[model samples]
Structure formats: structure tokens, C-alpha cells
Target: MRRRFWLLLPLLSLAGALQAQAPLDLPQQAASAQPAEAADYQVLDFDWQDKSRQREVPVRLYWPAQAASAAVPLVVFSHGLGGSRQGYSYLGRYWASQGYASLHVQHVGSDRRIWTGNVFSLIGRLQDAAKESEALDRVRDMRFALDRLLAAEQGAHIDRQRIVAAGHSYGATTSLLLAGARPPDAPAGLQDERIRAAIIISAPPFYGQGAPEPILAPVRVPTLHVTATEDVINVPGYHSEAGDRLSVFEATGGQRKRLAVFTGGSHSIFTDRAGTGGVTLNPQVKAATRELTLAFLSSVFEGREEGLQSWHQRWKPLLARWQ
Candidate 1:
């Protein structure tokens, strides 16, 4: 018995050593985490046809008037339910102004047409969006957008390795799927391996009261989730509260995940479009979104830690919401 105990002591010591050597996964939090005039950027437009999906995806491309270099980062922006590719033009222009090629992709079935004439139909539309087929189609639209851009002549200007998948509300859900977020019963191949980072705003849990662990299980990529204290969507058979958005922030597995919560703001703040259930527009929120989004992207794509650190130091006091 004494001989066996002594032999096990060495194994226990080795186990302790291994445990001590385990990596610490501390999240890179920021108070808030930009584009400027004279940023040397411009916009170009195109309409793409996804023959397989039978969808006409109209895209607005925002890029530097002159290529900054042989390659620049790409950011694809998807808008919320009842939003258009052009809905988030502010983000596209801002990113392009900051030297990225921002591609705004329009998801047909769930675009502005959903709210065109009847606000009463929103619940039905939301239910439809929750269906597996509709969700997968949205992801396919993004993947196909990547394919078209990477295959285009202008594709030469893009740094394929630094692509960002970003979206607002329902669009945020789409971006999550692309960034490896697994909803309750989603299809395979929804995640695009080319996505390096993601920016999701007002994202829904899509877990339906289930444990968020598995809902966000696939979200291993760097993600920045932005939402507001007033970011709540309650309708018949559907509800999206702040907790749902933050679940992504908490459940996503990575040291690079971040979250920014805005006080006295609405979920519509994430979308540039106003009149979204009376979301009073606030420029400060917009500014914070622009600055922090750029900083987050810089941190991941350019390895510019200083910008993130600077954001943490400066905006931590300015922005009321940080976690």
C-alpha cells in the first residue's frame, strides 16, 4: 500500500502542474469600443443574383476611392428584420471611410417588405424568420455574397483573411450563424470559416429558454455584442430582451468577446433606420457604435491593441454601459 501511494504522488504532482499551466481566458472588455473625413473612401453599388437561392441580393459596396494597399479588410453588414441592404448605410460608409470595403447584403424574404404596409404582420414575419429554412437562407445569402465579392475583379483589393460578419437584430442572428453560433435546431455549414470576427447588435437568443451554452456553442470567433437597456422587443409569440442579447456576450467561448450596453437607447439604435417603434435617435449612441466597432475590428484584424486600450480608457467614463 505504501509503495502504491508513493507512485500516485508523482502523478498527482504532474496533474497539479498541468492545471497550473492552463490558459486564463480573460475577456477583452472595453468601455466602448471610427471613421473620419479625409479617410480616402468611397462607395460603389451592385446587384447580385443568387441563382441557387432564387434571390436577387442588392448590395452597396463602400470602399476607398483608391485602394489603400493591395488588400484591405472587408466588413459585411446585414440589417434587422424589415431592413434593407441600404438600411445600415451609415455603417457601410463609416467603415469604408475608415479604409474597409463594406458590403451591405439584403435578405429578400425578410426585408422592409415585411413591414411595408402592415405592422400587424410582424409577428408572423418573426415566426417565419425563426423557421429553420428562413434562417439558413439568410446565412446562405451572406455566404454567397462572400463568394461573389471574392470572385469579383475588385476582390483583389480585399484581404480575405480579415473579413468581418456584422449585423443588427435579426441580421445579428444571421451574422452569429455565420460566425459559428448554433441556434436550437440550425443546419450544418451555416458557419463561414472565412469570418475572422463579428459585430452583433440586439441579437436574439434563438434558444427559446434553453441553455445559452449550446445556443452560442459555435461562436468561438471574436465577437462584439452591442445592445441597449431599452433594447426589448415584445410581440405575440416573440420576445427579445436585453438578457437575450447579453447571453451571446456571456456564452460565446473566447477571450476576444466583448459587449457594449447603451443606456436611454432603443434597439433601433443598432439600426440606422428611425421610426422603429419610436426609437428616438441619439448621435452619442451612434458615435459610440462607430468608434467601438472600428476599435474592435482594429483589435482583431490589425492587431492594434492600443486602439482597444485607448477606447477602454477614454470611453469607459463616457459610455454609461460596460460589462
Candidate 2:
């Protein structure tokens, strides 16, 4: 169930919008703050219809401190092929603390449990021979989540100008597709215009026979593609090729498009504090990954140019081989 970016064409999908003032549709838009000036963020779980998985999807959300009554920047996080809402918790917490609204979505059939036992059942869904609909479901899921969130009373509270889509591996592919990166044979309807930025981590070359195109190619928004040269899953497969594809975006007009490679890290290196078995949890990979991811997010989200510099300074020695 850990989906590859190359196999994306077969699984694109959709979400329905909720009406305003519906608490079930929106939940509490903001986080609760303690009286003592403690860390404040709203973490809530909500359900959305996932046509690809044919079930109601649950999402975990985090929001920044109540600094403004208007809409704030938003960061929607997606998990890897076999991941859950909890997979990208690190980004959610970090962004929420920095004044952005973030959400982690759970993909039912493609989650860890399914991958553990019924992976074939999920894979069977993608048996369209051509894999034309590979990521169709995930695309729908992202769109519906956006619709539901924006339709919520608090949805209006989100700063549409700064909406960002981010994820790891398959999730990163989802982020890219939502941001409008199309494989040569991709369906036209799958694009979501609301996404203003993208942060893709360890995405693969799953777009079938399409020539290598940067995930940021069609996106008019800023984008950050983060990968690890040591990534056993992607480096030899997708990361190297994607840079060529995404370069097209610069011509299309977006600001600050960048690709950051972590020298000593692996595919799952961008994970939260508690990383998956293959990436963050490993003793040798933990600290370096944590520092790099935190710094990358800080720079990309907070506009702290130093975030990039700090990452290079710390990892340049390890990544010297990449250079």
C-alpha cells in the first residue's frame, strides 16, 4: 500500500462540500488556549466522504494561536500510501505553532492496516490496466477536504492566499497533483486551483510513461520539493528526474521554487518526531532528519531564508557526495 508516484494515474478521486454553520462539517475551527499562555492550537477530527476509498475519511487538524479574526494561512498534510492522519503530525504541530492551519488526512484502504493485511484489495482497485486512475481517489479526497474546510464557518477564516499542500511519498505526489503538476497522460479535471504552495517529500516516478517533469511544473504557486539523496525509495527512481520536470514551473511564474535534498537521510526522513520504521525511528537517521525537516519547514513557511542556509551548513558534509 505504500504507493509509488509512478503509479499515480489510476487513483485520482473527489469530496463534497458542506454548508456553512454546520458544526459537523467544520468542527471548532480554532484551538483552545490555556490561561497561563501555554501553547495553543486547535486539534480536531472530522469526517469527509472519500469516493476513491468509498468511505468517510477522518482528518486531524491543528491551528495556530488566535492572533487574528480573519482567515490565516493553511497547510494541508497528506500521508504516504500506507500512512494515516497521524503520519504527518510533525508538520501539523510545527505549522500550527507558527500561525498556520494544518490538517492530516487518513486514507482508508491505502493505510498501514490495509497494507498489512488487505493490500491486494486496495491494489485491486487500481487494476485499470493502464493505471489511469491511480491517484484519482487521492485527488478527490484532497479536493473534498478543501471544499468541506472552506465551506465551514472557519473555512472562511483560512487565508486562501497562503494555502499549501504537503506530504510524504505518495502523499507528496498527492500534494503535487493537487498543486497542478500533471503527468503526460493525467486527466484534466484532477487539478485543484486553491493550492498556493506545495511541499513534496520523497515522491516517486509514478506518472506512467510521461517524460520527467517537476512536480511543480504546472503550479503557479511557490513550491518546495524535499528529498534525501540516501533515500532508498526515491533517489534512484523519482527525485532526480522530478527536478527536471519541475523546472518548468519557474517559466510559468511562481516564487521561490526550490528542491532541498537531505544528504544522509532516507525516504521517510521528513516524518514527524516519531518516524516510521524505515526513516525517522532509526537511530542513525533520527537527529539529522529532525533538524533538517524542522529547518526546512521554518524557512518555507516563515520565510526565514536562514532555514535553507542552516540546513546546508549542517548537512553539507554528509551530502558532499551528492555535490
Candidate 3:
């Protein structure tokens, strides 16, 4: 009987743990989101690379008009899962206007345009192994594009030393990996060089079982982490987990890093578009996200340090919903 009781004890505890309540006030909690803007940047669209004439990824470069003379700092941006390079134009264009060169890449096979399969399958793209390959490919794409843009023929005026790699969600994962977050070896060819800084927005977890803490610990450059309070698809508590892990690099006293959490903001809020699953809500969330993103990019890329300092101060109060 004691043996039976002991066996049942573990099951009972497991059941209780499984049955534990998840927090309910997600929407209410997410009522806080903020963004600010300054000016408009020049938009340039061009073909980056192609396997064939028919299959080529298009790139959009946003360059601040004011930076035509000076060599502006550069930011290479990747979009979220099921998103195109154009998806986050709101951020790309704004960052360019702030005296930075923003390069937005359209990932082949993984973009929202090619993702017309099952809904579950589409969701799976967020953490798929193939997406990892695409991530590395994106880094390569950035390297290749940098060569073209900086060359005398392409007419680009960008600062090579201040290049930053950034993305949203799975795109954010790509940014981390490019900044030296290595995954288990795949058939992909990803070079671990060239990135000076990183900005990861609501990235999903790539490291599974036995993956070390601070999976992206090798990132020696400055990093900024941005996430919403209610990012359900990206998983619970992930923003904090990533922030904590990346902070190790900061604590060891090497790189400059910061994590900003917005209340009442949803996963899609970080995106330029307002809706994903046919639900439209929270314009405030989107606005705040873009504003902060611009300020961060400007500070890191364009040497606009004062704009970065005034960011949280000017936007914090607006983030609190019903306050």
C-alpha cells in the first residue's frame, strides 16, 4: 500500500503542476506600448541575389537623405516568421531617416509569401531547422550586399565599422546567430564575422535540450533586446530569459546591452502591420514599438546618443494602459 501511495504521489504532483493556472490578464496587461518618430528616409529597392533569374530575393535600402554626404552607419534588418523584408518597413524607413542606412532582406522559402501551407505548418516555421539555414544565408546576404553597396559602382555611403544586424521574432533569432549564436551544425554555410552590434526583437528559442545558458553568449558586440508583455506565440517568459542570458555578457563586463519590456503589447505589435490572424487591434502598441526602435538604431548606428537617452523618458507614461 505504501508503494502504491508513493507511485501515486508523483503522478498527483505532475497532474497538479500541469493543471496550474496560466495568467489570465494578458490583453489587459499588454495595454502598454509606445513609439516616436523624427523624419523620413530615402527608400531604395534592388535585387540582392538569385539562384536563377526567376528566383531572386529583393532588398530595400532606406538611407537618410541628410546622410547623403557623410558615410552613415548601417543596419541590416530581417523580418519575423511569415513576414517579408517589406513587413517591417515602418522601422526600416524610420531608422534610415535618423541618419542610418537600413538594409531589409527578403528571406527565400521562409517568407510569408511562400508560406501558404497549413496554419500549423506556418506556425512551425518559427522554430524549424530549415529556418536556421535561412538565417545564416541572410547573414551571407548581408555580407554580399555590403560589398556591393560600399563599392564605387553601387553609390552607397555607409560606415562599415558601425554595422548592426537586427530582426523581429525568427528574424531576431537570425540576428543572434549571425552575431555568434551557433546552433548544431547543419548543411548551411554561415560565417561568424562582420556584425558589430545586434538588436533582437522578440526572438523565439532555438536551443533545445542541453543547450547552454546564454546560447548567444559569444556575441561580443552591443545588443538590445525588445519584447512585449503579451507575446503568446513567442512563448511565456522568453523575453526575460533571453535578457537574463544576454546580460551575462554584460555582467562579465564586455559588451553594452539592454532589455526593454512593454506592457499590454502583443507579438504582432513589434511588426509594422496591425494584424496577423485576422484580428486588428492596438495601433498604440505598434506606434510605440517603432519609436523606440528608431531611437535605439539611431544611437547605435548614427552616433545620436542623446536621442537614445530621451527615448524611455518620453515614451514610458504613454505605455501604461488605463493609467
Winning candidate number (TM-score) = 1
The alpha-carbon RMSD values of the candidates against the true structure, listed in the order shown, are: 14.2, 11.0, 10.0
Sort every candidate by lDDT, greatest first: 1, 2, 3
lDDT of each prediction vs. the true structure? 0.68, 0.57, 0.56
TM-scores for all candidates: the values are: 0.82, 0.70, 0.70
Cα lDDT tens digits for candidate 2, 40-79: 7777888777665576677888866673565688878777
**In model 2, which runs have C-alpha deviations exceeding 4 angstroms?**
1-5, 8-38, 50-54, 67-70, 116-131, 214-216, 234-255, 272-307, 314-323
Candidate 1: lDDT of 257?
A: 83
Which window of 10 residues has the lowest lDDT sum in candidate 3? 8-17
Of 1 and 2, the candidate ahead on TM-score is 1
